[model samples]
Target: MAATQYMTDGQGPTISMLAAGDASDMLSGYTLIEHLAQNKTAKVAQIGKLVDEQAKAHDQAQQKITDLQKEIKDLASQKKRIEALVKKYKPQSPSVGMGGVTPRMANVKTVIDQEEGPFPTIGCVRHTGDPQDHGTGHACDFMVTTGGVMATGAAKAHGDATAAYAIAHASALGIKYIIWRQRIYDLRSPGWRMMENRGGVTANHYDHVHISVF
Candidate 1:
């Protein structure tokens, strides 16, 4: 009769006969296959963890981009506000044939400059042969109409208020006289007086409020 031996199959507990050396080799091969399979499973798990970490990092990067865009928009809005303020307060250069503004005239000009109105321009001193307050750097002309034209209705009302304001603050501002709308307010007389028409708006002083300061 042939001799028989018992050994486990690699998959389960089924018994089979084999030479002793052959069984030992088969068992060693089975153990190596099992170890390889376990290693493959562990490698798959590590790859999955790495993929999850990469996905989390991608989400954080997108959030940072969104925050940076909002910051840029806010900075642009702030820049516009600063530019507007700069334009509003910027100093204007003197026009041709205009210079030599006095200290009192400059002070009064500062006050008028603070008023929110339709004052087109300021002309204080001029080079002329005529003996006028403007030629002596003691006067300022606040124009209401364009090209020395007559102002009407609302424009006239604005000019009236401007002239009145100059007269009202004359004592404090060292203003000697104000001429507007064919009338003159002399600080010496302290009243409005009608003037003879010199045949035009500029000559009659109807298009501007002329202030002479001490």
Candidate 2:
């Protein structure tokens, strides 16, 4: 039998026959396998790192959503508190007998109604009054006296306080004038003015605190 040969090429087909070992070719094959294994391991490690980063990003996004929800809740609570305060302190228009009160007069009446004990009896928009703001539903009469007599003691004090409050908040309440204790305080005037004798306490406005709204 003739001796057969063996040959191999790096980039071409191989030819096999009975032959001795080729150490360089074997070493090249082993190095190629080792390189492939290393590349695979590196790729896996990179993929794991990317997955961890994605998980962290997801957690951060979820936390942000939770924080925003809490902020919305807090804002809602604050809005409720503000609304309650407005309802308690802010003036409201009267629903009943709407024809008898103007917007400004209603505001003043609301403030007076909230005053402390012994509030005066209030009357407004009387048809029998002379040609004045009362007939036009723009005036209010806070009766500080009963049966033509002037109020005394705590009643008198309450009446005084009511008048003072009205005067102090005149601009805010849109007051045109105030008459009490036989004196008149007009918004156009600088100070209280004395009136001539009207013959009686009620006639002179001493028995009532009269307020006219603009």
Task: Quantify all predictions' global Cα lDDT against the true fold.
Answer: 0.74, 0.73
Best by TM-score: 1
Model 2, TM vs. native: 0.52
RMSD of 2: 14.5
TM-score of each: 0.54, 0.52
> How does candidate 1 score on lDDT?
0.74
Runs of candidate 1 with Cα error greater than 4 angstroms are 1-98, 116-118, 129-131
Q: Pick the candidate with the highest lDDT.
A: 1
Give the distance in Å from residue 105's predicted Cα in candidate 1 to where it truly belongs: 0.7
The TM-score between candidate 1 and the true structure equals 0.54
lDDT of 2 by residue, 83-192 (tens): 76766776432323336688879888777655522333677877773638888888877876678887778767767887888888889889888888888989888488
Model 2 residue 59 CA deviation in Å:
45
Candidate 1, residue 150: the lDDT equals: 89
Off by over 4 Å in 2: 1-98, 116-118, 129-131
Task: Tell me the number of clashing residue pairs for each predicted model.
Answer: 0, 0
